[model samples]
Target: MTTVELQRDLPADPERVWRALTDPAELAAWYWPERMAPAVECDPVVGGAWRIASAPDGTAVGGRFLAVARPLSLSWTWRWDGEEHESVVAVTLAPTAPELDTPDGTRLHLLHDGLRPEDVGSHREGWVSCLDRLPAHLGADGSERA
Candidate 1:
């Protein structure tokens, strides 16, 4: 199986970052395509169901939460609308160094595993765009000065 991994540092604390990931409202604000009217439902607990409406189609895509460790990590199954196969996504958050020039923030590590080789590139691009939007959602812009 192919895997996609991404890491990003944001000028926000772990708790704030955790909320952004687990909270449906926060997710709706930045998770979906910009042109789409965001619609999301998330149950932030292990085994809970989550769903997000896809752009232009309004079809929902989601799965159950596999793991939920508040302010630290989360893992879930992912399946798009009409797709039978499922992939897995895991996110881990940790505190960044305060001693560094950057302000105290959280480091986010994301792993998307169990993808078909052909799906890897698209998933990677989608994830990169999503991650790039995260810091702006947090009002940090991924900067130390934020």
Candidate 2:
């Protein structure tokens, strides 16, 4: 299986970043494509379930949390609305060092595994776009956090 890994540095603390990652309302704001109001339900606990309905096509994706480490890491099993095959998604957050551009920011790392090689490019693009919007969702002004 192919694994898609992405890393991003955001101008926000780990707590803010974690909320943007796990909160359903915050996810609905930027997780899907722009202008699409996807319905989201997130149960932020180990073994808790979550689902996201695509507004554009009405496709539903559901998963169960495999691990939950608040403000630090989360992992879950991922599958489409009707698909049987499952993949895994894990997110890790860490504090940025003072030498980095966003010194007090958070470093976000995402790993999506068990995907078909052909699906990697599209998933990567989608994730990159979503993650790029996270800072704005966190009320960032594109400047270093004080």
Candidate 3:
């Protein structure tokens, strides 16, 4: 199995970043908006169940929250139907020290592991595209448009 990783530095606080990642309303502004359901439920706790279906109509976006560390980290199971594949997605938000290039912001790191090598590119593209929109979504004058 191979792993796909993506990292992005957003111009937002960890709390705001956390909201973008975990809050349903915020999620709709970016990540998979076309497929994000009304967030039937979210517990954000270890061993808690998490599920989000697609839009236009409901479609299973299989997964469950595995661990949570508030605005720091979250891990979950990931799988797409019509494919006998399962993987783990872990996201970590680390605050960057004050610097010329990087101010008080969080470095968002994401890893998708346990995927067959052939699936890496697709997953990589997905994450790359997703992260590309993140900064804009969280920017000073940004708004969710995904």
Candidate 4:
């Protein structure tokens, strides 16, 4: 098994970013590849179930929450819609250094572990695409609606 790890500094505080990760409405805004409507639903609690799937049951990605530390960390099991491979994904958030940020921000770290060797690249690309769109959902002033 291999792991995919990524870190990105977001222009919003951990609290705002955390909403984007756990809120069903927020997740739908920027949790998917560009040009695809995301159907996301999550309970944001330990033992709760969450899913991000292509609209109308196209291609689903879902899992049960393993850990749900609000505004800080989240971990869950991951499985694709019709695939047999299963993996674990964990995300951590923290404040970025003052020197490295302007109006305070979150340093987001993600880890996807236990992937089959063959699935690494696509997962990496998918995550990159998702993260790239995250900032847009977080308003420039950080005061935008959740």
Q: Report every candidate's CA lDDT.
A: 0.87, 0.87, 0.76, 0.87
Residue by residue across 65-109, what tens digits does model 3's lDDT show? 888999999998887745567799999999877772558778899
Query: Among these predicted structures, which one has the highest TM-score?
Result: 2
Model 1, 123: alpha-carbon shift in Å?
Answer: 0.3
Pick by TM-score: 3 or 4, better one: 4
Model 4's TM-score against the true structure: 0.91
Score residue 4 of candidate 1 by CA lDDT: 99
Clashes of 4: 0
Q: How many clashing pairs per prediction, in order?
A: 0, 0, 2, 0
Over 4 Å off, model 1: 140-145
Output the worst ten-in-a-row residue range by lDDT, candidate 1: 137-146
- Sort order, TM-score high to low: 2, 1, 4, 3
Off by over 4 Å in 2: 140-146
Stretches > 4 Å off in candidate 4:
140-146
Q: 1-146 in candidate 1: lDDT tens per residue?
A: 89999999987889888888988988999987668877899998999999999667667789999999898999999998889989999999999897854477898999999999999999999899989988888874343344
What is the Cα root-mean-square deviation between model 2 and the actual structure? 2.0
